[model samples]
Target: MPELIGIARLAAESPSLLGKKRVEYMSLTTRSYLTRCNNPRMPFRWMINPYRGCEFGCKYCYARYTHEFMELRDADAFEKKIFVKSFGPRRFLGELRKLPVGESIAIGTATDPYQPAEALYGVTRAMWEQFARTAGFRIGLVTKSNLVTRDAGVIASASRRHAVTIVVTITTLARDLAGALEPLAPRPELRLRAIRTLARAGIRVSVNLAPVLPLINDSEASLDAVAKAAAEAGAVSLGANVVYLKDCAKSIFFPFLEAQFPALAGRYQERFRNNAFLRGAYPEMIRERVGRIRRKYGLDSSREAAEPELWPRDPQLTLFS
Candidate 1:
């Protein structure tokens, strides 16, 4: 067996917290809460994930590569084995000081900060509770859960002092399709409701229609449906990008496609064979399609010369978007 070190070692030592259904939640201790993002292409300086694994179980989740660091290789383990990080207010405050003035810190980069674990462990809420006390910072959070609305008051308080952009990822409005793609996540309607709630509270909210699958939900009409829903729900912007499948994500996603969309499997394999990213006509087409939809909905991202651009973070990306 390969030797475990750093995070992998910590994960091995962490004790089990609870198990529900086929999922098991554990607690992980870290030296610090903020991870300095070293990717030069990344816009943010730092990233935060309150939990390591997500129970949302979206088959295409790219963050699944995170578990390999902890020596976890089970395909289902990424969804089933969740690790909640320990949080301390003083440590978080210290970490805040280490950041240079005016850089962005993104929450939920790797996992949904407000996933089911947040309701139980409250690590994400605790971090926001601290953000509520400070001012003049740029923070972004991305999630697919309505649970974020539960902390609406606190998030609002944090935003008053900082430039906070809350991104709610809703890939499709077709309820059954969404249920199939993200089996354990909240319904699409509920996520839209979350956008309305946050926008009503005066928080800037955006919609991300990510991983625009080839033949599945990539039609012009399908994209229009989501953009229309976003505008009606009071979102400030709608951004989308085609899905880029890394080897780690493909391990699970390709099988999922084969099982659920047999006809498209071979095509997907060929398209992604030589490159994880599709660089030519397909990508350009999606960009134009989504751009038209955004224009149709009158959606424009909130940008300021004095501040950093917050999200929809994928190169088209999430530490995360």
Candidate 2:
């Protein structure tokens, strides 16, 4: 028999958690719910992903590589085969308690914490439910779902205890285009509603106009529309990043373009064939463009430096910097 060592072993033996006709939810036993991000460039000190696969299935998702660790190589598997990590309340809190106070922890780094499964599994819900009891930590959550609005009260309470920021990613304001790009995510209008609701509840919220695809949605007008809506909806900050395509994402994205954006596929294939990050003028221009938009709306950068005294006991940290 072939050796199924480490994570692959656990992945193979995981029990079924839930089943949809087109999707399968598996229960993955986990030793630690929190992980340290050693990369110096990462803004947060720690990361947590409640679920392994995201059903939103955005055509340009860069997180596709995460599923490879489970030995699932097919691109579609990231969306179809979901893994819900087993959660033990006390244990989850225990691991959390061990971390020093005031350290930053980013949620949903690899996948959506509030993915559709979260409605059923409630792992993300449990996280905030427990976090409300804690004091003095920096928490940031990134998601593409408006389902987070359901826990607005709990999140607001937790915000009172610790520094909490919720970032709702809306790549475009055009509903049809958003549907085409992020097929399964909530509509752009719903996401904007979530932002307004969260902001009204006194929770700090931001907008991420990320993975700004070249020649697709990167136009000034396209980005400006998202920013204007985000600001009008009560977002205090906004951030945008150019698309970074790795082999894993390319395998899926390239084919998606051929089918949906055939005219642009060839250019994208050539541009990103060698490098993952599109550096130089295009990215710099985006930086300038996003900067202009941020100023125009009186908004802050999502990774803008935190006030040094937000947590006086520790050194200041930049979120997603």
Best by lDDT: 2
Kindly list the per-residue Cα lDDT of model 2 for residues 1-321, writing each as its tens digit.
Answer: 578888788999999977898899999999899999999998899999999989999989999999998888898999999999999888878877777767888999999998899999899999898887666678899998999999999998888767889999999988888999999999999999999999999888999999799888989999999999999999999978899999999998999899989999999999999999997999999999999989999989855324323343533321210
State the weakest 10-residue window (summed lDDT) of model 1: 312-321
Per-residue lDDT tens digits of candidate 1, residues 173-291? Answer: 99999999999899999999999999999888888898798899999999999989988998888778799888888999899999999999999999998888888898899989998
Where in model 2 is the C-alpha error above 4 Å? Answer: 302-321
Candidate 1 has an lDDT of 0.85
Local distance difference test values of all predictions, in order = 0.85, 0.88
Residue 177 accuracy (lDDT) in model 2: 86
Q: Give me candidate 1's TM-score against the actual structure.
A: 0.93
Q: Which ten residues in a row have the lowest lDDT in candidate 2?
A: 312-321
**Each candidate: RMSD to true structure?**
5.5, 3.5
Record all residue pairs in model 1 with backbone atoms less than 3 Å apart, i.e. clashing: 109-319, 109-320, 313-317, 314-317, 318-321
